[model samples]
Target: MTTSENLTAPRRPRTVDEHRAFVASLLAPMPAVEVPISGALGRVLAADVVSAVALPPFDNSAMDGYAVLAADVAAASPDSPVTLPVPEDIPAGRTDVPTLRPGTAHRIMTGAPMPAGADAVVQVELTDGGVETVVVHGHPAAGQHVRRTGEDVTPGATVLTAGVVLGPPQIGLLAAVGLPTVAVRRRPRVLVLSTGSELVEPGSALAPGQIFESNGPMLAAAVADAGGEPELLRFVPDDVEVFAELLAEKAGGVDLILTSGGVSAGAYEVVKDALAGRGVEFVRVAMQPGGPQGAGRLDGDGPAVVTLPGNPVSSLVSFEVFVRPALRAAMGHPHPMRPVVSAALGEALVSPAEKRQFRRGVLDAADGTVHEVGAPASHLLASLALADCLIVVPEGVSAVDRGVDVEVWLLEA
Candidate 1:
């Protein structure tokens, strides 16, 4: 069944696939912008990056050596070296160059353009260290050690395709092509809100029944890691009117909104109370640690909102399972999901038959085994930090024993 179908039928817990597909339907790539190539790292390309100039641009020497006609050195050997006069030196960045004389050689440095009539370079290591007269001990084939023009890339070629994330390698290529800037999809701006009257900021002294607010910073960081710009709002009290007022006041100029806590069936669920029937759908997804979820666009032209459970692990898992892909989609990334691999479990573990379990795991790549990082409880925040992957268990299965193969989504990649 489709995700929208699942959301509309809230009686049954929706599968992870259904929820994710629904979330994907809510997002599109953000607008494009021309940014300096130097600042384009982690940005998504909006259009194919066509090269304006060829790599290497000209035929140049690949080593510090003598540039010569290959025929002149073809018969030379150590015992009978070819002795030729070096008329001039060619270093990198030299514009003025003279063609090689039939009977002579030129001292050349790496990256120096080859002179006319020179088809090969004999490295300095294979020649006598001479300036006026150089002795070449070895013969070189024609075109040896010469970097031909357009060898790496040609002008007007699509060097990078649209939707590719610009990393260090991509940035270097654009720089090599002499481009000062490139067109890329802008990172989505996300507003993160942690809701609850019982929440307090970290490092502040807490009163009775109060816990430090961790979801705001954690979700913000997750947003940043997913290539979205994040702004964390101060914690909101558990009152529907105040929550609605803040959302209305700050929802402008943002692409999306994320709220943690106040999304469950509790009496003081401010988010549900304020957003119910407004636009959002609260659903019980068939997943452990992140079953309670909500998503919808705001009234008029307001930003899309996603509500996650308040427990640290549940919120993070929800981000990984749903919000991350949505943010990546808005960035124009073609492949938004985490890399997955099949691995054997190191030990046995039990799970609820009705809910898909995403247990924190440490993958031993050396042995191709995965082990649970800590307890399966949703509040185990420290365990999430220790995990490198999420061990996925299907909903129909109640237990996964030692050495059982299962799907694992890598969090590190």
Candidate 2:
């Protein structure tokens, strides 16, 4: 009842670009939904957000000072002062105020709307103050220290465009524009499954030939980080009949079905047995550690399925390479892949003939020269854990000497 019981030879390995383009073509964007502004962080915008009103709404004081006519204070200097009566007081958020008369100054507080006929403001530190009179020893230029209406944002202007990821600054901008609700793309639903009779959960004691299950939790975290809601399917045994039933049950409500293991050229690969000739294609990829990969829709369900390798490092790397980009596209993210840059190889590396290598390394730019961190072994999970980038070595190329410039994919900037 295992995959070995169902007979077939392994298909030819596919190139990385071919698999990537296939996954990209299969993805569709999620629908939009309205959510509270506070809950919209990290979601993509569904519509262009236009400003309802101009920022500031009125001319306001940018400083706490005396609002005066620039013409009256033009000739005033430290040696010869200008004395004017304090006509009225203006504080922030006050709408009842009279226009300033000539030769008189209005005491204004910061953020208070500027009264009519006032062309400039002088700081309190530069004026001699009394109960009703003040002397200005400094002349300020016209329109100085004033925040004009629409200075930050004008009405009918697009404040946020569609497909923009909402972050802290974006939330603040939307709130400042008086928006209490926002339209964002719905989160994609992902179902994660772990396959293998040799696997055991983390808390349970392991027997001989059985290892703890790490792929389920690791891939779930990756899916959530990529903006998908992950549903953890219980580990399926290495029996074709059981796995087929489980797959059918879980595929009902998911946007994607992700599985780890049972796609390689092994004697007892149950996932391959259950999914063989059932609308899914399993093939070895020309990559180390994560050589075995699969993708296609399930037989009866519309959700796409991606089968990754069994090793912990392999599962994570394959998720980063294939599944993450596809999920981002489904969620309407503008940029679906990590940014890549060119860097120098701090050490020499040897690679295989037909496989492009992604070596885990740290990228340092301290002296304006990018350098790699450690060895380029795919099984070195410790190196991958500490790495900020992956140095890409193309196929059929080998022996990159020290100080040679190479391409690096950054995990984060």
Candidate 3:
């Protein structure tokens, strides 16, 4: 059925899974770009990274000690220490390492290449820390302190798999494998629009019935955090013609267009009134604080448009539940959803039986306990700011008592 027909008929609430599946089907990984290792931080790898050279390239000493044949020190002890002449000192990065004689020792520092004819190293602490005439006091077994070549990483081995995120450790590994640049998925570009005649920009004096607009800026920042570039448009008045004109102009340059407010079934809903019968489908999703939803492609395959509720909490929650995952998917992120964990609730909570609930919560990871932040109202932005997680109450359940275990999606991760 067409969107308009569905709206007029008896509407069925869309399940969260159903909505997520729809979103996943719409977004695919973005195109890849070659970027220098220094600029690849936080970007998803587009291809497997194979090591061009082995780490450490050569066998080296694992500690500061004397490199010698293990048999030469087999009988040395504190009472009858064996003394050997240290003809050379091997510090790290020394390329010209001299081979040790049968009865002599070479003083070696950590990470220095092991000289030929030496099978083991006696740690400096066990050898009186000597350099010239080393006084060996312990019997170090063969290969006791030797670091074998290619031990950390082998050449031609896949050091980093595709879809891996490049953090500090990943960057270091890439550098170690001699990768100057890597191919990474491109960041999505998004356009955020907020609609409402009663909306006023922050820092401006509010009239008796005007409230400061917030959803645009908040969602824009959230998009950037999800690895997407965002362009936030000013408040669009409650007029269908103006909203359509602005959307047409802004939608051309972005991968996706997101709008806040004017999506619910109200007479003054500019988004619903303007985009109705134009491709976007308005549905009542079976979730609290973000139930009213709309998504559709713009004219002739223009950027996909997603409509979120106007309330500060609802808009932000909708972005987390829907838009963030979509953006991550476009960026080739392996795990698009936020990290989820089950934790016991610190207090009792109630929810409507027919609708799923997502309430602001503070998770104590140290103790695995989650406390409700405030009332589960869509307009409560203050409590949303303090929340580090979203405590989920399934649609099949009605009320959850204190100490009950519920699934929570971590926001800080």
List the candidates ranked by lDDT, beginning with the highest: 1, 3, 2
TM-score of 1: 0.95
lDDT of 2 by residue, 69-148 (tens): 99999988999989999979998988997899999999999999899999899888779864499999989999999889
Query: TM-score per candidate, in order?
Result: 0.95, 0.89, 0.91
Candidate of highest lDDT: 1
TM-score for candidate 2, residues paired by index: 0.89
The residue ranges of model 1 lying beyond 4 angstroms of the native Cα positions read 1-10
Runs with alpha carbons beyond 4 Å of true place in candidate 2 = 1-11, 128-132, 367-379
lDDT value, residue 309 of candidate 1: 96
RMSD of 1: 3.3
- Among all candidates shown, the one with the greatest TM-score: 1
RMSD of 3: 2.9
Error of 2 at 244 (Å): 3.0
Give the winner by TM-score: 2 or 3: 3
Question: Which stretches of candidate 3 lie above 4 Å from their native place?
Answer: 1-8, 365-368
How does residue 64 of candidate 1 score in lDDT? 96
